[model samples]
Target: MSRELSTRANNVERLPSIPDNDTNLIFGEASVRYSKGRLLGFVTDEYIRAVRSQRKSIDGFFKALRELNSNDAKSLLYMKNSLDDNSHKNIAFDNDDYKNLLIEYLKDHPDPLQEYNDLIYYKIKNNLPEKYLDWFKKDLRCSLFLAFLVKKSIENDVYKGRDELLEEVVDYLRYDIEIFNSDYSQNLPHYRWDIMKSGERKTADILYIKSYYLKNRLDCDKNISWVKPTDNEQINWMYNYLDDKDRKYIILKGMFFPQTINEKYELILASLDVLSNVESPDIGTKDKKGFSLRNYTLYSMKKAWDGRKQYEANNFLNENSSVKVTKENQPKLKKLMKFSGFTANKVINHSIEQLYDELIVDKKND
Candidate 1:
């Protein structure tokens, strides 16, 4: 990331680029897509976003959308047989099926996405018709649920009660399923559980609500622990701060980088973190909520490197410098401690006395 190394690092693999003008060179497919999205105002700004692997996140949304589009009745439900109440396989669902479906996509894919797949599934169950989908209500519910979690994230991790947090989720989902049956979430009817007793509950596989029902289904004095995978966009954002790639690359190929225009530099994602950065530079901005647009300027090795650091310093510096990923997450925690320099929490932190002044402040604003 040092400015001095930009020349060699910019096109280390001898990758080609496309000249957009006297200055910029489109590096990869992502850069191309990002350029278009940003030019049109789809992307908010150029900064290191909280998605470590934009490709994976992009693919997840695509797969989720595809899953929603599938007319296959069986695909809609993960058959009750596929998941058992207390069985080992049921408790630990086969994540591989879902994981594979979300990989192999280019990072700055032009495809749209929705992180609320599970939340949406909770709304209508498996009732998405072959056409005429209404995204308004489900989007609202997702927004509310997301806002609640964001508020929780800012709270002191200690004072937070466990079940109270979950109760809020169930309360939202349990509000009569018909609440989302309309095109507008604001138009939802009053909270009610028994709108129609005989209505089909097939799509009622809503997570927290399902947990809410488990208690009613069992007569024994048992405490049901409803566990849901942490795939929420917020959680993934947190993960990106620690899990980002150690280095970014800029080798370009494909149509964007050809012949005479192949040597230009474009500022894509977080260049210091991951490469194989394309116009959708292996290093570019990726907001999980919308377009993974790559922002750029006239090409220059120094310019690209500086722009990349400027962005990273603003968005990801604190998360990268504050925690003990080197200690806690590392097997060397105890042994590294003997050196007297090791200090911090399990993640990018358990504590922060030794954290640098840079980690806590939002440098972009100041």
Candidate 2:
């Protein structure tokens, strides 16, 4: 996969941001509650580790904690479940020891979020919780999760709005689809079957991006093939070629533009159902161990793209000389053909419509 495609494929794990200043916008109650567990999981590693080091029976620790407050205990477990398995397990295993240790830690560090990081502490201590929840009904855990998400976003430096994320998905989809449109790619030798315990697997990059298209674009379902679809047969072929989960993944990404913030968080929460904490992949390994939610979350928390549009194709063309092709301008036409993804042979053989389609000019211009 191209660097661009890989970046976009991993974008589903991005955390939404809150304003650094006093802004009166509500993120929507559903969205905040939806994202609370994930945000808490990302920040509670240190606390989990400290508790687990002292415990041997994880279930016992939970049972004792449940005795304190079953509802909060359930929320905390949900938060723990959202974390990479190792951290939560090591933090608390044995019942009495882990329970006492956690309670002691909470007593000493009454505000775990504050102790988790300086930035999170600052945001929460300063009264930003009022932005997400009713000031009077503030839940410490939920507020901390929101703060932690913001802190993580600040640390990662990658924040985007619905439109920005959607545009990125479209750009990446275009690049991936066009790059492999050659006879060599059509040959099965260029592709390999995934080794699996069960079920089917396809090319990693294609599988990820195609899912984004199917779910996000109404027109996308009409043309599912690697090549631009010109007929129903081609479209149907690609659609049927996809696994059912591939279709589900499209709905999963929401084209990166969800209708509501709550809807957006709902998508992230959905991942927990399919992925297990035990399966967390080390971000350093890039082999066929396959895409890990761990890697996705880590990578997402670290990337940011500002002013992405400045690098679009039209800008590249504008920066180059603006020249129109006419029957009298053979020299200019010849010069144009020398550009990448173009050549004299291709220009002469393909009609204007075909050339535009192949170059993705129509999609990009839009």
Candidate 3:
């Protein structure tokens, strides 16, 4: 069995690698351009300087106290007595300066805040949580501060007038979506399974496999094969495909599992679903019969389970209560549920159901 699995895995040769330069050409000139260059660079430098200055100030303050001479001891005591007053005065002055600088920057770059605000609004329009957007707004305080604020608000469920916000955001995202969707071959491979999981490729890179290879993979296994359908067969399959959650798992996996930013993939998923009927497996099928039928292999199932568990654990840590779960948590959970064992589909389905229930309660309260 082990040899058989090994041979099967080995037989499945990796798709041929495309040269990085070749893959990047698909993005055209716009892809080559840096969208966040100036803003990102300025923010990074400012953050680094602030951190260094803070460390230096703390070190100097401690050194000054430690090296106080006998004659300066009295002066030190006097300084200590006036410390709160001096500190308050300094704080007020600093705050005023900071505010002035912020205002000047905003005036010079009048549209950054607006651009960010619009960008965030677009995300909300696409079903991102209001609370998350609001949280981003509060946490990322800078030129794009308002945008981050909106993000945090959405994420944390603090953003009100959601319908209005979403409408505005949709209008904003439309332009970018148009550019992204215009070239399918250029964009599709970046979102593919192997490239995303490999981590060798950069996010900005335009990755793709030969269409022929993709079709071959789909048809290799019967159980996992993409099913082709006639016009009559399409409607029944389409209804089941969209309406049945189990059938929709592939869509979910393709859209959400690989991408860090859900919004972009969500857009792509919507575009793909519209352009090609995934219900007709023939859309991506290589051979006449599609792929060869094979049962869900243990290896694939385990891989799926592990991936889902990691996703859930990270999500739970990020959004839920402050109770910290260490690296050992998942292992602990597995131990606690040892009797059940690890089955990726079962674990993911169960976890999602539990999370869905909690979300329902949370929504009701809201």
Candidate 4:
């Protein structure tokens, strides 16, 4: 996942999967099906943003879809059309069969894994003339893209403009991302199927899928607390030791001011040491389900940092240019306090007579 998250921005346009022939790599990755699902998710997200305004324009849609699919199925994502882009394309509509095909495919196959696998199986079963399952993938790409786009757009409350609503019914992805719901997805490597079955496991691809998919997961909401730190070291820390999804919470709920990478690293290391130390308050601590250990540690760091000024104020006295209480005189003051015991009071009154002698000598000299 660290490797995957680190290289995402460059690969947004070029999703990579290992050659199916490479069993070691396949077994070394996330579920191949899941990796493919992430790729399909990306493609659809882009296409959705592009042609969301049209439903009846199946020809134009497929042309656009084919254009996307044709481009190595890993098309470059030029994110066009924000809330401001108004130059909607005028594409001709017809091809009921094409429209029906997409609608039916989307209705039947929920994820790209199924969409991709079904065609692959079909190509194998029938001994189809197609040499590469690649052709079938191209055909289904439109449907897959549309399916996810329709769902995502709805989930984000993004409908087409006033001229945007239409007959095409969108099945929105649930607000609570279903991926995290899976036991295996939440806990990786340990739960991955290949590792359990065989010693040499494959899960790099899964990490990539999860990493890439997470980038666009909350595209719809601006108010969400997903703090995506682009720093490679930070991302590596998250993917390696912490859950990527908990980033928002573990990072002081995005409340912490930015620190240099070295500072963050040091703080995290310090916090971890404190948590593990038997004498520390964090020794037996357990954060609530939603609140993470990192979150607790980060707040503790803040708390400690905040209390420092107060600590110095109470423990150290500064007399600001009056007769300075040097280390030499401090012991004298303490001895005076001890000798006087507050009853005689005379012991306290004399600055041991030294200061009076010095002042009188100075006056006589003057």
Off by over 4 Å in 4: 1-66, 69-72, 75-296, 308-366
Cα lDDT tens digits for candidate 1, 131-237: 22222123322323322223322233221222333333232233323433322223221121222223344333233232322222211122112211232322222
Candidate 3 per-residue lDDT over residues 1-366, each given as its tens digit: 011111111111132323333312222233212123211111122322322333211122122223323322322222222332442222212323433433343334323223222322332232222222232222211102112212322233222232333432332222222332233333232222243322223212212222222332322244322322322232233333443554342222211222222332222223222222122333222343331121122123335546755775665555435434356765665454443443433554677788988898778988
TM-score of each: 0.18, 0.17, 0.18, 0.19
The segments of candidate 2 whose C-alpha lies over 4 angstroms from its true place after superposition are: 1-247, 250-262, 265-274, 279-291, 297-366
Select the stronger candidate by lDDT from 2 and 3. 2
Local distance difference test values of all predictions, in order: 0.27, 0.31, 0.30, 0.30
Candidate 1 contains a number of clashing pairs equal to: 26
Model 4 agreement with the true structure over 1-366: per-residue lDDT tens digits = 011111112212233332334332222234332224322222233323222332211223223233224212311111111112421321223434333444344334323223333333332232211122222122221112222323333343333321122212211111111221232343221111122232212323323433433332222134112323344433344333432453322222122222344334322332232221112344324653333343454454445435653553333343313335667766666555444432113333465476777888777988
Off by over 4 Å in 3: 1-240, 250-366
Please name the candidate that would achieve the greatest TM-score relative to the true structure.
Answer: 4
* Candidate 4 global CA lDDT score: 0.30
Q: Among these predicted structures, which one has the highest lDDT?
A: 2
What lDDT score goes with residue 30 in model 1? 36
Q: How many backbone clashes does candidate 4 have?
A: 8
Candidate 2 — what's its lDDT?
0.31
Give per-residue CA lDDT, model 2, range 1-366, as digits (tens).
Answer: 011111111121132332332111211223222224322222343333433343221222223232433322332432333232433343323344544554454344433322323322322232112122232123222222222212322232232434433322232222222332221122111112222222222133334322322233222223212233233332232233221453332122312333443434333332222222233345334663544443343233223111222333344455335444455766765556534335444455465668778688778977
